[model samples]
Target: MKVTILTLGSRGDVQPYIALAREMIKNGHEVVICTGATFQRFIEENKVSFYPASADLMALMESEEGRDILNGNGFSLLKIIKFSKEKIAPSYRKSMDDFYQASQGADLIIYHPKALGAVDIALYFNIPCICLPPVPIMYPITEFPNFSLSSKKSFGPVLNRLSYKLVKFSELPFIKEINDFRGKTLKSPKRKAGLYTYDINGSPIPIIYPISPFLFKKVDSWKDSVFISGFFFLDSEEETLPNEIENFLEKGKKPIVVSFSSMPLKNPSIFRKKLVQALKKTNNRAVVLTGTSGMRFNQEENILTVEKAPHRLLFKRAKGIIHHGGVGTMSEALLSGVPQIIIPFAVDQPFWANLLYKKGYSIKPLQEKNLEVFELVQALEQVGNKEYIENAQKIKNIIQSENGIHRAVKHIESVVDNIKKE
Candidate 1:
């Protein structure tokens, strides 16, 4: 079978799809990853075919409009949209062409949120396409509120349904643009924009949530079409730590690993200073992994900074982790059996952090807005608690035991087989 996975965004968004593609190739299928140009070498290095679909994510982040968003200006939605239109119009058009070409001659299409146009492309080709969301937002469920919304208060089933309605209506602005692209490019019948995400009548499409049920339990209100496979964790063949990291581990008691991969920072200096202060207050040594933002610091005997390191390898030796609560990072931390101190910025991160806290695996997450050194210290203090460590280990065991990638492969194969039978 030939499969093309359309995806974009940071490594957190793109990495899991690579895991899935690698698994498919091992199972005797051809797979290609359609993503940004920056990941071409990385994907090819992983032995997967690469299809460049957009500009590098870091380039997008470093753009003026992206800087505004990253700086926490709290711009209104309309202003943000307007900025995106002006900045991204040219690149987005080119990306659409790349996506259309990359998707040709595929047995199946799997897509993330950033590639919603893949739905129209798949429809044009009359092939099966699956919506794979790393988070729990696409489907409506009464079990809990949508991950995007900050509220956890439950009213009733009606309100639960309304939450999805709110998210659906939020797409109104982009609907015309998306439909216009379909009309011009694919020349297919006009599609209702909401159908790309939902089925107003029944189950719209196969929506797969590639996260552990242990982390987010299956909600009864979800439609039959939804499948909650465990997280598609990518365990690299090489797990060796770098010499400096090894030396750091040998030189002191286990240190907390702090990282904020891809989370835009308004002030790197303040953030760095607070992190150092928090570690000092807790009397903990630390390793900081800063990416793209070039977060730098003066060398200290107890602190080490690196551009990047494998979380799967480093988290196992660390006493605790302080991170942005990204799903990929959370999965790595959980599997490593390390307690976490989450400083969530936006978009489902706070949701994951709060779930961990509610499940007793970590303290309540500290919001990035107005974050202070004292609050970080307090969270670190909680990490030493016996209950939190025990809970972290329990969740770790659950995650470690699952064969997530194989299970996801099975799910994908089933979806493809059923489509063929039809």
Candidate 2:
């Protein structure tokens, strides 16, 4: 079977799908990844077909307007939509065109929420599509409020589920663009409503969420169509550390791995200075992963900075971690069995940070705006506490037992088999 996977956003968002695509190919299926043009080479390197589908989010994050959004404490739903519309305007046409062309002759399509247009594209082709989100935001969860809502406080289970309904309603504005694309670009009946959510067969698409159930309980409200596959990780081949990193690790106590993965800092100088001060105050050594920031720093005796490293391998050797709470990074930290100090920026980051804290594997996170040196030092110190280390090890065991990619592949094979029988 020919399988097409559509995804968007940062590397964190696209990386997992690539892993899934590779697995499908190993099982003797043709696989294609439709994402931003920036990842075209990376996708091809993995021996998967590549299709350009969105703007370079890293470029956007570095733009003045994008930096403002990231630096802001938080944004209301409308504000986020407004900023997103502006960013999506220039590339929206090209993205739709790319997805349409790439999806041709595919038997199945698995899509990220950012590529909602894929639903209609699949309908037009008379194929099945699965919704795959790294987070559980696609469906309402009575376990807690929707992570994007920015309130950690829960009113009740009813209100928790209602929060997701509000999030769904917010998409009403995008309906026109979705239907307009369908009408203008593809040969299909004009959608009656705005969003192309349902399949041509009038069934709710199956949704596969790749997150560990230990992190958050599955809600009883979801249907059988919704499946929670554990965290999908693409294991790397045995990686040798750089000579400098190897030397540093061999010399003293394992340094804390500090990274704010692709998050554009408004005042990078100030952020770095405070980070250095915190490390000094706590008298801890660190290896900072500065991804795409083009950030250069004069390394002190205690700190070493690099453009990148294998997080899965590096985190296990670290004393602990200090990072922006992107789920990809959080999963690595959990797997490493090290306490984390999260400095959340926005969106679902705060939710993940708070979840880890509640589970006793992390210290209370410091919001980006409130990231003072003293507070950072305090959080660093908390990582050394015995209880935090013990709790972290417990969570690690649970995550290591999960087989997310294998489970997702089994389900995908079932879908393909059913379609063939028809």
Candidate 3:
């Protein structure tokens, strides 16, 4: 089988899909990754075929409007919509054309939510497409409100379902633009904009959530086609830290690993200083993996700031992790069996952080907008809670034992086999 996976975003966003691609290749399937140029080397290094998309999300982040949108308010729905309408309009056609180019001979299409053109192209090819969300937000569940609009409070079954409807309704703002792409670019039917995601596709598309059931227990509310196939955790390569960082780690007692990967901050300097003061207050050292957060610092006594390093290596040796609550980071931190101190910025981050807090894996999350030194210090102090530690270890045991990639491969094959039979 030939599989084409369409995706975008930061390193964490694309890394898990690479794991999926490599697994499929090993299983004797031809796999191609269609994504931004920033990840070409990254995808090729893993020996997967690479197809570059026209627009790069990192370049989008580096754009003036992208920085303004991403920096302060932290990735709210409105912010995403606004940016998509204004900045992304010129490139929307190009992105869809690229997806079409990438899907020329694909037997199946696996897509991240960011790559919205996958469905239409899949239709053009008469192939089945799978929605592969980084978080558990693609489908509606009665157990909780939609991940995007969820708050700290549970709204019961009815309202929880309605929250999902609200997310669907939010899609209305983009319907006309998407329809234009379908009709003009793909020469496809003019799709009616529905108040939800699947409605936009006009059929029930299979969705597979690459998250552990330990984090989100299996729910009875989902349709048979929706699956929870554990996290698509990338294979780790053995890598040593820089000499200076290794020295710093060896000198200190498990320094805190602070990595706000690709999350823009309004005032990175203030955020950096706040973390420093809090770490000092808690008598901890740190290694800050500041990728695309635009934070830079002079060499400090106990903190090491670098553009990138292997989280697989660093998280295991860290005292704890302080990070933006991206699903990828959340998965890595959980795998390391360490507590997390989450600063939720936007999208499904709050939901993941809240779930972790509720499940006793992390301290309560702090608002990235209003984070103060004292509050961070408090969360740091809570990092050593006996219950959190035990629970983290328990979750680790569960995750370590999961073969998500193998299971996911089976699931995808099953879907394709069923579609072929139909």
Candidate 4:
């Protein structure tokens, strides 16, 4: 079978789909990944076929407005909407055209939830497609209406519903634009504009969520078409660790790995200073990953600050992790069986933090604006606590037992088989 997988965003978003693609390839299926142009080299390195999309978004994300948006402030949604209106929508149309032209013989399409055009294109071609929920799948869960961070709500179910209503209403224009694009480009009938709805082609598309049940409880009313595959991390064949970091870990004192996971710190100097002060307060060593934000730290004997390192290789030997609570980062930390301190900045970070806290695997999350040296120190101390470690170990066992990529492959195959039979 030939499968085309489409995803966008940062490395966190694209990596899992790559993992699933690789798994599909190993299972004797031809696989191709359609993603950001920046990842072309990454895909090539992985020996997977690649389809390039716009590369400008990554640069846009590094601009001042982009940084603010990432920090959970500023007009991110408007900027995103404007970008989509001017740049992404057109890009999507072209990319989908290219994908369809390239994938002439594909058996199935697996798409990230945000890759809205992929679904439309699949519908136009009458091909089987599946949605991969990189984060929580939010439409309108009666129990938790605010499952999507895009919604605006403080805390109640009514508020959540109101939030969803507002968000849904806000996107009506974009929905119409997308449907019109589909209608003109593919000559298909118009359909609703939500992430998971029946398209013009009258196919019931399945959404595959890559998170474990431990983080998100399955809603009873959730469509049977949705499949939950546990966390998928594309294992990088090249594992390189700095000699200094390796030596620091071998020094015997438990080291806390601190990272913000590519989100820019709101105030880098202040954040770094407080982090330095917090590490000084504790005897444990520290390795801080400053991802593209250019936060400089005073290099001390006990503390090492680097631009970036692969989490899959580094998280394994770390005593604990402190991060931005990205789904991918959280998955790595959990799989490492180490406790974490989640300092959620925006988007799905808060949700993941809340979920981990409820699961008893993380310390109470420290919002970036409200974070203090003492709070971080306290959280680091709690990492050594037996209960947190025990619970983390249990979660680790469950995650390790599940073959995420294989499960996803099987589900995709099932979807194809069912479609063929129909």
Per-model TM against the reference: 0.93, 0.91, 0.92, 0.89
Cα distance off (Å), candidate 3, residue 420: 1.7
Candidate 3: which stretches are off by over 4 Å?
73-83, 166-177, 194-196, 199-203
Runs in model 2 deviating more than 4 A are 73-87, 167-173, 192-194, 198-201, 292-296, 419-422
**What lDDT tens digits, residue by residue, belong to model 2 across residues 278-305?**
8899999999988744356894879999
Sort the predicted structures by lDDT, highest score first: 3, 1, 2, 4
Instruction: Give Cα-based local distance difference scores for all models.
Output: 0.80, 0.79, 0.81, 0.74
TM-score of 4: 0.89
Candidate structures ordered by TM-score, highest first: 1, 3, 2, 4
User: For residues 1-422, could you state the per-residue lDDT of candidate 3 as single tens digits?
Assistant: 99999997877679989999999999999999999898998889889999998768877877777887766446577877788877675565577788888999889999987786677788888888898887766677788888666656778988887776664554365567677778887887776554225733466788888888656664778757578888888875756777877888888688889888878777788888898899889988889998877688887878888888888788988888988888888888999998888998887788888888887888899986778899999989878778777877888889988878889999999889987887
TM-score (C-alpha, index-matched) for candidate 3: 0.92
- The sequence of per-residue lDDT tens digits that candidate 4 reaches over residues 56-120 is 35655777666666565665677766765776566655565565554567778887755656766
**Where's the lowest-lDDT run of ten residues in candidate 3?**
192-201
The candidate maximizing lDDT is: 3
Q: In candidate 1, what are the lDDT values of residues 306-376, reduced to their tens digit?
A: 87898989998999998888899988888999888887778878888888888888788886568888898
The best candidate by TM-score is: 1
- Candidate 1: C-alpha RMSD to true structure equals 2.2
Better of 1 and 2 by TM-score: 1
